[model samples]
Each structure stands twice: as structure tokens, then as C-alpha cells.
Target: MTQFSFFSVIVPTYQRNDLLAKCLDCLIPEIQTLPAEQYEVIVTDDGFQITAQEMIREFYPWVKWVAGSRKGPAANRNNGAKYARGEWLVFTDDDCLPDPQWLEAYAEAIVAEPACLVFEGRTYVDRPRRSLAETSPVNESGGYLWSCNFAVKKQLFESLTGFDERFPYAAMEDVDFRLRLVKSGYKFSFVKTASVCHPWRAKGGWNKIKQHREATFIYLSIHAEELVNINSVYYLLFALRSFVNQTVPAILQFNFTGINEAFLEHFAYLYMSVLLWRYSLTSMKSLKNQ
Candidate 1:
């Protein structure tokens, strides 16, 4: 067996203990394939109500559990990276279950391209059968990166300082971080054979709107100029079309009953747009000051 270097798997979890349990179960056996002392697993609890300490003790005695500063996922990940003891940091969400050959694939890729700073992997939904979308090709520009299945050199992570904690929600922080990495001349390779199952269900209804809103804010923060570009007009049109498709019928049916309720529920998108504009102006001001 070819020897592999040390690796640290960091999982930043919020309130998904059940999924986390399964993720850890999948991780242990994969890590065992490497030198026993060359791997460590760290789980950072992002202020989830349940005591992760006890859960770790009971189910994952070999893993390290750290109390995350009551910050969002980005901050929790940064905290996890701080405590990692390996030369490479592999990030996977609490809800992700890795394939049996996941770690081995990463090790092989690292050996093939030692200068690569980032390793991107494929994700499939946890289901009985794979769909066309599950098997689609992925590249860096296609929004193919997910924290659920990515690996980075430890020194590279430290140099970049991990994910930006400024994003308070589960949103576009990942995009912003990857953009920075790309700008810094870092090379990333997609390891299609290394895969994981993202078990979280798709968000819909008001929850999805809120997610979009949060994401829009982060998007605006990083791409303020692009928002005003010609392409943005097309995006806004698409968003408006979607809103009308979702809301006009309800309005015509005198669903005034659900109007206020719906507004309260889905208004986060509008709020997020407003905040994005505000953040953009703030960023501009800071740039001017500098």
C-alpha cells in the first residue's frame, strides 16, 4: 500500500445530528485506509441546541468535537480549520455521506498534482438511483463547488484565512471564497470519482426565497458592479417573472388572506436585495477611503 500524507476532515454542523451520525460512520472506515495516525476528524457544532459533546462521546469517540463560536457555517468552518492537525483539510458538511473510495481518490489526486491548492469532488443526492443531473459534468465556473465535498491544502487554507464569516447565513460565502482563490492563481481539479451524498432536501416555498435573499446579499457584496451590468437586467427580469408566476394567481383569487402572511414569509428576498445594495455602497465607501 502506498503511504499517504496526513489529512483532517472538518465537518461544521448546525442542527443535523442524525445526518451527522451517518456522515461520521462513513468517514471512519475511509480514514482507516490511510495510516492510522495520519488522519483526524473534527466536528464543529455551530451553536446547535443539542449537546454535541455527548453525541460525540457516544457515537464518535475517536473524533474531536469543538464548540463553534455562535457564528454561521463559514465561521464554524474557520474555527474547525484552526484546530485541524493535518497537512490537508477536507471539508464535508454534516449531512454528507462519503463514498468508500473518497479519501483514496483524494490521496491519489494529491500525489498526481502536488501543487494543486483545491480539490473539488462530485455530489449526488441520497436516493436509490442516480438521475441525469447526478451524473452531469462539473467544472469550476458551473457552481460545482460545495463545502460538502472539497479539500484544500492546510497552508493554502491558512493563507486564505478560510471562508469569510461576514456572511451570516448559509449562502454565497462559498462563491466569494472560491472567486478569491481563483484570482490568486490557485489551481483546482475536479475529482469526479471522489463523491459524497448530500442528504439535505431541497428548499422550497418561503424557505427558498429566504435562502435566495441571503444569497443575493452575498452576491451583491462581491459583485456590486455586475449587478448593474447588462446581464443583471436579464437576471432581474427572470426574478420578476418568477415572482409573478408564484404570486399573481394567489392575488387574483382574493387570497388577500394569505397576502400579509405570504409577504411576511417571503419578504426576505426583497429585504436581502435592499441589504445587498446597502452593503455594496458600504463596500464602495471603504474602497474610496483606502
Candidate 2:
């Protein structure tokens, strides 16, 4: 068996111990197939309670577990990167389950291009409603690169100072990191074969709304320039009109109508407009920072 002497897989996790356990279960068999001594897995627990630690010890004894000092995801990732012993750091989320060939592909890609700074991989949502719909061309400018399936050279990661902890929440930090890499003239190759399946769960309305709002912050933080530019003004105006059209009818539903079709249509448009504005703001902020 070919040996990889220096590679580390770092997974930053929160309170999702069950998910983490499942992810590790999927990973261990793959790990066993590789040259064991040369590769390591680091699970950085982001200040979970004692129960989480106990669970990790019991369920994933072979993987190294690092306790996060009350840091957010960005900080947690940075901490894991700090202690990584490998020349290359493969980052994935706690919820992602990589294919068995995942690490093998990374190793192959590294061998093919030893000087590559970043490798962007593909992620497939498990059981998509429509596979054809899932295969659309992703807009890189729209921040499609997910942290759940990306690899970077260790030195490059350190040089860039890892992820910007300024993005405290779960949203746009990845975009900020990618933008920095782009500015630094680092090359990121899209590796379609290195895939992971991201499973979904039922989300409540409040949960989804919060997620969308945070995503707005992320979009604004990274895309500030576009927001201020002339093209963005047109998009902004359209979004404003859409928001008004949607919201006004929905509000009118409270007084004049009782759950009519127009109310639903308007509410949907209003929600879409909110997302558009949020993304525009993120793009505008990113431009300003540049």
C-alpha cells in the first residue's frame, strides 16, 4: 500500500454528537484502508458539554478530539488547523459524510499538483428531489464553495491566517476566506470527483428565517462592492419592488381577505426579495473591503 506520511482531516463540530458519530463511522473504514500512522483525524469540539466529550471518547477513540475554548465555527476551524500535523489540511463539516474514495482522491490530486494552494470539491445533497436540478452550473461568485468539502495546503492556510473569525455565525465566513485566497493569487482547482453527501433535516420556520438572515449578513460582508455599483442598483430596485408587491398583499390579507392565493404569492415574493437584498448586501460589503 502506498503511504501518505503527512495528511490530516479536521472536522469542526458542535452539539451534533450523533451526526458526528455517523460521520466518523463512515470515515473510519476509509481511514483503516490508508497508511494509518501517516494520516490522522482531528475532531475539534466547539465547547460542547462533558457529555459530548465522553461520547467522542467512547465512539471515536482513534480520532483526536480537541476541545474548543468557547469559539465559533471559524475559530474552531482555525484551532484545528493550528494543531494539524499534516502538510495538507482537509476540512469538512460534522454533518458531511465523504465517500470512501475521498481521501484517496485528495492524495491523488496532491500528487498530481504538489504546489496547489487550494482544492475545491463537489458536494451532493443526499436524495435530491431532482438530480437534473442538482447538476446546474454553480456560480462561484455567488459563493458556492462549501467548507464541508475543501482542502488547502497547510502553509497556505497559515499564511492566509486561516478562516476570518470576524464571521462569528455559520454563514458567510467561507466566502470571506475564498475571496482572500483569490486576492492572494492562489489557484483553486475544482475537483468534481471528491464528493460528499450532505443530508437534510426538517427545519422549522423560525430556524429557516434565522438561517436566511445570517446568510444575508454573509452575502453583504463578501459582496459589498457589487451592492454599491451601478448594476447592483438595478437589482436593488427590482428587489424592492418585489418585496413591496409581496408584502403589501400579505398584509392586506389580515384585513380584507382570508388566506387567498394572492396572499401566498405575495408572501413568497417578499421572502425572495429579502434573500436577494441580503445577498446583495454581502456582495457589496465584500467589494468595499477590497
Candidate 3:
């Protein structure tokens, strides 16, 4: 069996002290269950105009607080990993509340899959739903895993340089990293027991949609092949297909909640598609000049 020395829980926060406090609340007790040297919690603040150091120190004195560069989430995560002194690097966002036995589950998985370097824990929302259609505990989705909850060997994380800071935000950086790791032939195992609760808060505005559109372009550009011969209309068609796939079954089953969620998802896609297509020409020109 492969033996790991310790685990480092790396959380990147940006002015989310309240949520971070909740996260630490759940994590600290769990860590206390094991020996002190078994794991360390490192919170990296990404250029918060007002630091969380004081609050964290007062309430969660066990946590290692690090002031971060104004760089985006990816950079902040990388920064946290740099200070980590563990054989395994466990990542969870400040907004996530990990399960009581989250660490034990991951430790077990590591032993079970001795050859695997990457492992993803499940994340779901426990709060009341907005609509029956809304998705919660998104890590339940079988597609790509999010960095919101996962673990990798410290050596391996450093080998990939942690995350691609070029993506500039919490967006596509996870997807980009996963794709690259998969291409490099690394197997990832999902441990349902190592779950975390990522609560949802409805942000009422176009700002999120705008961020999605911007991230979509950045995502495609990073992939290179996806950007080739692609236009806004292509994304529109893609969105239409996705909408049908998501909403049709719900409609047939008379699942109003599911249908509502599907509609919202589709609308967001359509909105981004139009915005992306509208600026694709200008965006491409700018990228080419750079």
C-alpha cells in the first residue's frame, strides 16, 4: 500500500468570510478527530480589499491564513498549494461544507486505488430548492468534476503547476485542468462518501450570465480545437440541443420544477450564445494580435 504523510486542505477565499467560517466550522472538528499532524487547513485569500485574517484567527485559530495576490481563484489555489506541506492536497472552496467523514473517505480511497493520483469527492446542496427543476449538489452530475471538491497528490498537483492561472477566474480552469490530466492518462476515482455541501444562492442579475459568456470564450480559446471553425451560431445550436436534452423528459413527465430549471438553463445558454456570437469576430481579432 502507498503511504501518504499528511493531507493539506486548500481553500481559496475572496471576501466570503461568513461562508468561510461555516466551512471551517465543519472542517475543524473533523480534522480534530485525527491527529494534529495528520492534516493542515490552509485558506488563501485572493486580494480581499478587507482581509479575513483577523476574523479567521479569532474564530478558527487552527487555520493557516495566507494573504493572496489580487490574482483570480486559480492563482489563489496555486498559492495555497505552494504553502502546503502535505503529501496529498485536498481542495474545497470556502463556500463548501464537507461531510463529517470527508477526510477518512478520501484516505480510504487513496489506499484502495494505490495507483491513482486524482480523486473527486461528491458535492451536493442540502438547502431547500428554488424549484423542483433546479439542480443541487452539482457534483452529482456524471460529467466533469469541479475543483470545488477534490484531492490530488501534492507532487502531481505541482507537476501540473496546480491550475492554469491564465483562465483568470474560477471558471473553466477546473475543466481545462481535468481535460489535460485525462489526456495525460491519469485515472480519477469518485468517492461518494467524501461528500461536501455546496449551498446555492440565487444571484439576481445578468452579471453571472455575462461571466458565463466571457468564460465560454476563454474556455474555447484554451482548448484551441474547439475554437477552430466555430462561430456563435454553432454555440446556439449546441445550446438548443442541450435544452432539448434537459427539458424534454421533464416536460413529458409533467415535472414543472424540472421543466422550469430546464427553461432557465436553456435561456442562459441562448443568452450566452447570442452574446458570444456577437463578439466572436472582435474577440478573435484581439486574440490573433496578442
Candidate 4:
């Protein structure tokens, strides 16, 4: 009989050794008391740099490290999942610090709810947001299954095809997965005891916004039927309404952050709408010609 771990914590990382080191420092000690056979940790690096490799080798040699697919976090996560040898695959980002009782909380929850397969863990942000632009993947009450901290049965993850690698960006991939899971109709238990601390991540810019728009496009395209009632047109109208209702008010107040976000997010929706309209027309034309 082959022995397998009850939980496999798969962390997807990319070119952030400093953050990854701090995360590992907090994560490893949490699992130390647990039997090694019961749990395992795997770090999948997208960058595959020598510094991180050597750091883990010299300091934390017990943890498993593998090369990420270099595509995106979604792909990297899928790559990490391939190496998982546990009943449950718990995913957390490399920048998150796991609470001391994180693994044990999940273990206890599994024992308590033997029928549950999906689990959403709590993600606490350590710092206050300086601006609305400074985003963080924090889930306090657990409706938001932010990829920072969540666990799903290995069987279910594989059955649902894991994170949709079709997403070119990390924007809507998790949302896509969540939508699929919701469609599956399994109630995801929110495990508040299983927690991780995530620092505020300042990741807003024009380029990032554009990438997010692309991902949203793919998400809408894939879920067109499910969202047929309120698809891209509804979002485009919402963006227009936002500009009229919120952006103009923020402009009068002279809030730079609000104004900046309005330009970055609201206006981009109009841009995306035009792009999508053109794409649809071109698709129709190509099909007619063929």
C-alpha cells in the first residue's frame, strides 16, 4: 500500500525570493508538529532563478521545489498540482504568511466535515490600504475564494480541470474557476481558523489594467451562455453609469486616486467594448466568407 499525505500545500511563486523566504519562514514552522506523512509543501517557481533555488536548498531542503511553466500563475498552479500527492490540494501564494495553526485547522475541519470537499480559508491583510488602487487578496468572511488561501479535493480539482489555463492573465481565472465550482453546486465551507496573512500588494497600472481587460474578455467569451442575460453589454453600461455617477463626483472632489482609477478602469471598459464589438464583427465576417 502506498502512503499519501492528507494535505499538499502547493505554493506558486515567481521571482520574489525575499517574499517567498518570509512566507516559508512562517509556513514551515506551522507544519513542523504534524507528521511528515500527513502533509507536504511544494513551491513551484515560475522564474526558476538560482538565488531562490539555492536559498531553499541551503536553508529549507525538506520542502519540494519544482519549475513552473513560465506562462502565468494559473499555469504555474496547474504545474504544481501535477506534483501533488495528497488527498487535498491547498493553494496559497508565495507572499502569504500562514498562521501557526493553518494546517491543523484544515486537518480539524476535514475531520469534522468528512463530506466536505471544498474549503475556503481566511486571508487577513496586515496593512491598511493607502489607496483604492493598492489591492490585496483578503478574504475575511470567506465568500471571496481568493487564490491566496483555499483548499479543494485533489479529485475535484482535477475533475474541474483545475484553474483555467485559457486565461492569459491572472485577473479572472480564479473567478472563472469559482463560477464553475458554483455551477457544480457544492457548498464551499469557509474555514476561518485556517488563516494566512497577506500584505498589501501595489499592482495597479495601465499595463496591468490592459492585461486584466484581456482576461475579462476571455472570461466573458467562455461564459457567454451562462451570462447571456447580463453579458458584456451590461458591464459596458455599468461602466458608463459609473463614469457618470462616480467618476464625475470624484472629479469634483479632486480625489487623485479616484480620478486615476476612473481613467484606468472605467474608461477602459468602453475601450474593451469597442474592441469586442469589432472582434464579433470580424468573426462573423470570417465565418460568412468561409
**lDDT tens per residue, model 2, 1-290:** 55553778899988888888878876784443455665688988885454357876887788888887555788889988888999989888888877777777777777777677688777766653321111222223323566788888898999999988866666667877887888899878877766677765433234444554565556555665534442334444655674467435554444533234333333444565565666656656876999
Tens digit of per-residue lDDT, candidate 3, span 109-152: 88888898999998888875554354444877445668889989
Alpha-carbon shift of residue 43 in model 1 (angstroms): 0.3
TM-score of 1: 0.75
lDDT of 3 at 137: 40
Better of 1 and 4 by lDDT: 4
Q: Lowest summed-lDDT stretch of 10 residues in model 3?
A: 128-137
| Backbone clashes, each candidate | 0, 16, 4, 0
Off by more than 4 A, model 3: 1-4, 30-34, 132-137, 141-143, 228-238, 241-265, 274-290
TM-score of each: 0.75, 0.72, 0.82, 0.82
Q: For candidate 3, what is the total of clashing residue pairs?
A: 4
Report every candidate's CA lDDT.
0.73, 0.68, 0.78, 0.80
Residue-level lDDT of model 4, residues 252-281, one tens digit each, is 565556456657777677777676667667
Off by over 4 Å in 1: 30-32, 128-143, 200-204, 223-231, 234-290
For candidate 1, lDDT tens digit of each residue in 163-223? 9888777777777778778878886888987788775353355665677566665666566
Error of 2 at 179 (Å): 0.6
Supply candidate 3's per-residue lDDT for 208: 52
